[model samples]
Target: MFNSLQDKLDKALQNIQGRGKISEINVAETVKEIRRALVDADVNFKVAKDLTKRVQDKALGQNVLTSITPGQLMTKIVHDELVDLMGGHQEGINLSAKPSIILIAGLQGSGKTTFSGKLANFLKKKKNKNPLLVACDVYRPAAIDQLKVLGSQIGVPVYTEQENLNPVQIAEHAIEHAKQNQQDVIIIDTAGRLAIDEQMMNEIRNVHQFVKPSETLFVVDSMTGQDAVNTAKSFNDVLDYNGVVLTKLDGDTRGGAALTIRTVVEKPIKFISTGEKMDTLEIFYPERMADRILGMGDVVSLVEKAQEQFDEEEAKKLHKKIAKNEFGFDDFLKQIQQIKKMGNMKDLLGMLPGVGKAIKDVDINDDAFKHIEAIIQSMTPEERRKPSLINISRKQRIAKGAGRKLEDINALMKQFEQMGKMMKMMQGPQGKQLMNMMSKGMPGMGGGFPGMGK
Candidate 1:
């Protein structure tokens, strides 16, 4: 998402990397370039200026007149400033009340309802809360149906009063329903207009007063850039939202809203919705985000995602299979499914140090593996288990069955053979020695790539 900004900043910092000392003139030139990068990324003018000013001051103040690389030192300074720009620390939701009401407020097309469902799923899985998603957007029956579908997907109940036109009454009744059903968390999805108007603003304010929510979140589309910041200011004027939820971050967004919203609205960004999946929502961590912006990756978050889907028993079985040269197509398919569950392919790869910048310009479609999956699925049980048994005739049949070319089948088989060899080698005694060497040669590579740590 910060692809352009990262490139520009990298170039700006490169100018100082070879310097033996940090000079005021050189730092000023680098800071000017950084400021230009921020401005071009759609960051607010005042914010970009103030951020560069702070970074420059810090770099100059911390100057030791030694041989420390000015580029790395200044990178840290800019990273810290970026974190402070986006709310220095993570702010969690307030779910203290027995039936905590989280009022959702945003304009249309801001992904308000989607974030509501994702929030419910997150709370249900991570917070152990019985969340009831209330559909209070009486104007759009589609929104009510959408919420119901999402609730069904997440195994959460949806509270809807189809006959009621008043949102305040609907939310109030939903609170009562939550009490009856023992739902500890209540998320109300209110109506939104194409743009902010007095009628819509007053309606949301009334609903806010009636529900007396523990938290009010203003959802915004990050793709809107500066308009997202302006809209947030307007909503904050009336709703005084407790936090912001930036959605559609997975799109081709410059990510200016994430950098500028908190400074403008004086609200914490509690959550960020990456993709459309219910599992795509994540708590906004400023330092980790700053890490990503500086091309350092977010290895901590990457490990957490892996642990969420890692099965100890399955790993042991896979290890045994690898040791015995019995790792078959079934095992490979299982691994693929687990990786798919980790989130978007590009997003997952982006978590690795240096991978994001390497593949930023590549068109990473979510369905990139579909053809490979189809080819694997078309293989017979015996053929999948015993790849060496497949001859040219079998390849032709499988290619036709998968609707792929004969070359594709041959390529897959070749890749599988190479992978089997690698697995066998990795399980051998020599592989253990090599692993020990690597473990001692470089640290943190086992958990994540090197150079990701501060």
Candidate 2:
């Protein structure tokens, strides 16, 4: 994600470290380094120059407080400037109209179809709206099929007319279908081109005219860097899009498009697509992004993701099991599954405060639990329920069945034992007191036992 740019910015700020105040020489060095970093990240030279100038002007004008070091003060100033450059506040999509229409427009391979399905899933699960995905990319039969496949995966109905060649007609007919079917939202996925062509622009314009969408989003591939910004400008020139969608942010983007697109097009980035998964869509927040860019983890977003995936009813049931000393391998496997559903392992861990910077260079694979899951699946129901009964011979058999080594099975057993002991401790008086304290401090930790406090 912007690892290179982050490193460069960190080094730039280090120039003023241990200094008593922001001196002219130090400010010049810092601003120059900052400008160089931006240019290296594929940002436009003019934009980088202008932004650094503003940052320098602000840095020199402010009175330096005696308590803070020059580096810390400068970092704060730069962070603020970055946020301002990226649209100071978060902007939400307008879904006020009944069957609110959202038209997706972008270049081909910009992830428009995938984003449309993700948006439908987000609206259905997060906003409690019945969304129908409309496939208007008639030029490519495969595109329509892709949308249909994604729609099926997310359990959302997709509206498409195979015989319809005109996207405007398809969108209009889809809207009429949504009204009749009581679908609360209609997301029309239109066709796109490999580049900015006149025919493609006119087709999208026709769809926009007919649908009159509450939100028209221009999706762009962040990996394209400056090209992404240029394409965004071109799209906005024709359609005047309401917002931007930056896709593939989980890839090695140089941070150019994210930093320059908002300033270039004057449109807030409404959503960011971190991965191809249906649940990978996230609302863009300028302050949080600045924190991430500065190597500070985004704890608020992490907590919100945890809350979204936390199941109250399931937690209650799990609490009863823990109280009965019945926390078994099955329960442990289920917990791992729930965590996997939250997001990628490194992404989830990086969201914790202080963890992102600590593990910046470490590689954390999302498939870390693959062997453990295989081992658990190899166990019989009785063995999973009563893991204590498994002897060395049984462990060998399980390991052989799971295609793993004996030591791996033993390690898993040790972890399970530790988890069981922790659950039992949570059933005691001291654990109850700890639970009460944590519940008072954490809003989502207000249940009976350890597992219950999701």
In the range 1-454, model 1's lDDT, one tens digit per residue, is 6888889988898888867666788889999999999998899999999999998888888882353666778888999999999999999899999989999999988999999999999999989999999999999899999999999999999999999999988888888899999999999999999998999998998999888899999999999999999999999999888999999987888888899998988999999898788999999999999999888889899999988899999999989988877888888888888888998887788887788877777677879778889998999999888887899999999999999999999988888888888778988898888788885766555444332322
Error of 1 at 285 (Å): 0.5
Question: Tens digit of lDDT per residue, candidate 2, span 1-454?
Answer: 6778988998898867755665688788889999999999988888899999998888778854333666778889999998998999999899999979999999999999999999999999999999999999999899999999999999999999999798887887898899999999999999988999999988898889888999999999999999999999998998998999999999988999999998888999999998888999999999999888887778888888888889999899889998888788898898989889899887777665556666677777788799999999999999988887899999999999999999999888987888788888988998999888875686664223232112
Give the TM-score comparing model 2 with the true structure, all chains together: 0.91
Which pairs clash (backbone N, Cα, C closer than 3 Å) in model 2?
A: none
lDDT for position 450 in model 1 = 32
Worst 10 residues of 1 by lDDT: 445-454
Quote the positional error of residue 74 for candidate 2 in Å: 2.0
User: What is residue 287's positional error in candidate 1, in angstroms?
Assistant: 0.8
